[model samples]
Target: MATVEVDQDLCVGDQICASMEPEIYEMRDDGLAYVVDGMEEIDDDDLIAAAKDAADACPVDAIIVEE
Candidate 1:
């Protein structure tokens, strides 16, 4: 499984990660991007790739993906 995280402290509410990977990242009511619950461990390769892409697209580099 792949491990994913979003550091809210560094998040700028860009929503890039959410737009890029809705299944892995979401824009919370607080305006910061967050890793979807139960998504800390992703088993699908497509989802993992999406998570990595989202991490790369984050303007503030708030998303983290470790596979």
Candidate 2:
């Protein structure tokens, strides 16, 4: 399984993660990116790929994926 996390302090609210993976990422009211509830840890291959893609797409590299 992979753990997905977003560093709110570093997030610039670009929404790239949310745009790439809406099911796992979202733009919160604070104007930062965050992993959706219940999606912090991912076991599915497709979801993992999506999460990784989102992490890579983050301009500020605020997204972290731990396997």
Candidate closest to the true structure, highest TM-score: 2
Task: Estimate, for each residue in 1-61, the C-alpha lDDT of model 1 and write its tens digit.
Answer: 8899999999999888888778778888999988889999999999988888888787888
Clashing residue pairs in candidate 1 are none
lDDT of 2 at 8: 97
Candidate 2: deviation at residue 58, Å?
0.7
User: Highest lDDT among the candidates is held by which one?
Assistant: 2
Q: Tell how far residue 32 is off in model 1, in angstroms.
A: 0.5
Q: Which stretches of candidate 1 lie over 4 Å from their true place?
A: none
Worst 10-residue lDDT window for candidate 1 reads: 55-64
Backbone clashes in model 2, listed as residue pairs: none
Per-candidate TM-scores read 0.92, 0.96
| lDDT over C-alpha atoms for residue 19 of model 1 | 84
lDDT of 2 at 16: 87
Candidate 1 global TM-score: 0.92
lDDT of 2 by residue, 12-58 (tens): 99888998899999998999888999999999999999999888888
